[model samples]
Target: MSETNPSDAPSPSDPSSPDAAFAQAAELQRTGAYPEAADAFRRLARETLTLNVATNLGACLIETAEFDEAEHWLLTAARHRPTEPVLRRLLGNLYVEMGQMERAEVEYRTGLAFRPQDAGCELALAGLLLSLGRYAEGWPLQEARAGLNPGVVPPVEVSFPEWQGEPLDGRSILVWYEQGLGDQIQMCRFAQELKARGAAHVALGCRPVLADLLATAPGVDEIVPAPRGETVRIRDYDVWSRYFSLPARLGTTLQTLPTAPYLSARPDRRARWSGASGVGIAWRASPTGFNARNKNVPDDLARRLLDLGATSLHPEDTGVADFADTAAIIERLDLVISIDTSVAHLAGAMGKPCWTLLPRLHCDWRWLRERTDSPWYPSMRLYRQTEVGDWTRVIDEVARDLQARSAA
Candidate 1:
């Protein structure tokens, strides 16, 4: 897994050839060195085309969030090695990154059937199921990260309780938040459930922007911003559990979930947002990595919706153009029409009506075998793509629906 610098790619015209270059790229990718990996692969691809080169190039491209080119390499690799489980697994990972879970599941399941206990395959399968809201199926698969979660997360930097298992009647504990905002909102439902089981104070770990807005969310007693590596007072609290880990700790499935509106808005924002059938919109996430490819709708699509005579508020990066720094966006709008990202969660937590757009393949946990509506957030509606890259139709449908709503 030792990574070589991209600048270290063997010269294409060098007599030694593309195999060395590809091997070098693959090593770079393994070492978590992406930039170098990408340069190495690009060199190999220009001189000759091969399944090995294409697959590695595709993987590097995915790391760069260059889906257009990555898809081409992955598809080419798939064609060259149709029966290879490893190659197929790589495709599944790409699919998962692109928010295409159904296709990812197919690849993961196919690979799992051959190499049943493969940890990588299992984790991917679990994550795919979890993201889809397929709680029942995903929990077991997703547990592969049981030991690794702590390693990957930037440490809490404080000595505090790590909450796990059934509620200790009437004990206060910090319910730690992690991952993206979408995860925090989805997991907020667990806060109330924890309270019902004997948790009295749920001090939420949250970003400053979300603190006040989510204070009224169900199951929370307070909200605090976390400082990197800084520890805070536990003050009568017994433990902390990761937000997403709540479901697993609680033995929950979609059927047993507290599938109700568990989050509420700042009462002040609520009054201001009310209008003729209020709604919200968020069309982008931090535009880097897998999120960029999956979450952002085309800007023209966003502009088009504005043109359609919808009273659409620019739901992100309000001061500047395009969706960014969501708190400001949430403060202004009544409802949100957005792709599946943190903004959707923020609006949902505010108890705002949201229409969430989903790619056809979708994220792994969004599940291939499933429902259009999200059980995690009752106020949110799901609109999915019928085919890949066909966002226009979905956008049109949403625009038409919103336009109709505006008229009514």
Candidate 2:
């Protein structure tokens, strides 16, 4: 790690000094000014090639999708410091973006070989294995993600012991939600599994926005509202486990997927928004947090769907306060068409017909590769891009399907 004085301005005439230039670039990157940081880092790399400069510059280039430059700099830096796991991890990420999974695996494994405890490399490898549908190899590796500060998910801390799929006839377990809303929704189904295993009581913690909606989910005896980005208030639980980890601990496979429609929306809430069984659409996803890429459909896709007689049932239009509000509207819609967002998960949880449009690159591991359907959500259908950024093809196919449904 490096430190720089925020007030120290580099001299204008000779600003490319390693310390000053690196400091400036580091400051820009720290402040989330990525484009400026990329430019500064490029200049620094041109002047002098230090591992820090090269690696940091490579990271910025990757963020900006300047892959060629990123690869050059990252490879150069890795060559310079062959033992450096961080550089290899960065290179692995670059390969993932380029859809070269094998190369990415080699880089990640090589990185781990050099630094066996590198959580980032381990997590990268875990995700790669999961994406390839190697659940047995991937899930145990996923435990490496705990206590990591790399911003993928929030930290989970508990004083109680972790329950690893053991029977709990007279015990209690706390199931804390992890990651985004969709992740919470998708994994909450396991809370029911825990209850079915004879737990005395199951306390489910979730994002406050989803607590109300998820209250109706089976086996959630208690709903604790864990506000987004805030540590959950854990109380009176004998043992705990991350909700997402339940599958691996339970030795679950595609064939062992739980029954569908384990969640239900409030009937009174749904009645307020009841209308004709029109199609629901949600195009743009919230741009906040780590999922800012690879999932969002173009903003105009909703309008395009509307042109073909699809009605706007997006919760955002109804002054929707939370997932509860969103769930209410989804309950009445005949079908939901969305990008890879929480809405898709909600629709799937409720056993509604949902068609999710997936990006060509970095589609979620749960969706698997080249699949038209989801194993986790039986009612959900997947429409994938034929090429990168090719939403038009996905939308066209969806439109054709919609027309056929109408005709029938």
Candidate topping TM-score: 2
lDDT of 1: 0.64
After TM-score superposition, what is the CA distance of residue 84 in candidate 1 from its true location, in Å?
A: 11
Could you estimate the TM-score for every candidate?
0.70, 0.86
Q: Write the per-residue lDDT of candidate 1 for residues 1-408, one digit (tens) a residue.
A: 122211111121222344676666677776657668878877877887655667777777766667778888778776655656665667787777676768888998887787776666777777777666677777756655545455333345446667668556978777765665566666776778788788878888865545665676777788777554565554545777667667777888867867566555445544444443445455666653234565568878877776765344444323322112344445466567878776677666555678888865434354333466666667778888776567899888998888788788
- Candidate 2, residue 81: the lDDT equals 76
Candidate 1 displacement at residue 277 in angstroms: 8.1
lDDT of 2 by residue, 380-401 (tens): 9999987766788888899899
Least lDDT summed over 10 consecutive residues: which range in candidate 1?
1-10
Quality of model 2 by C-alpha lDDT: 0.77
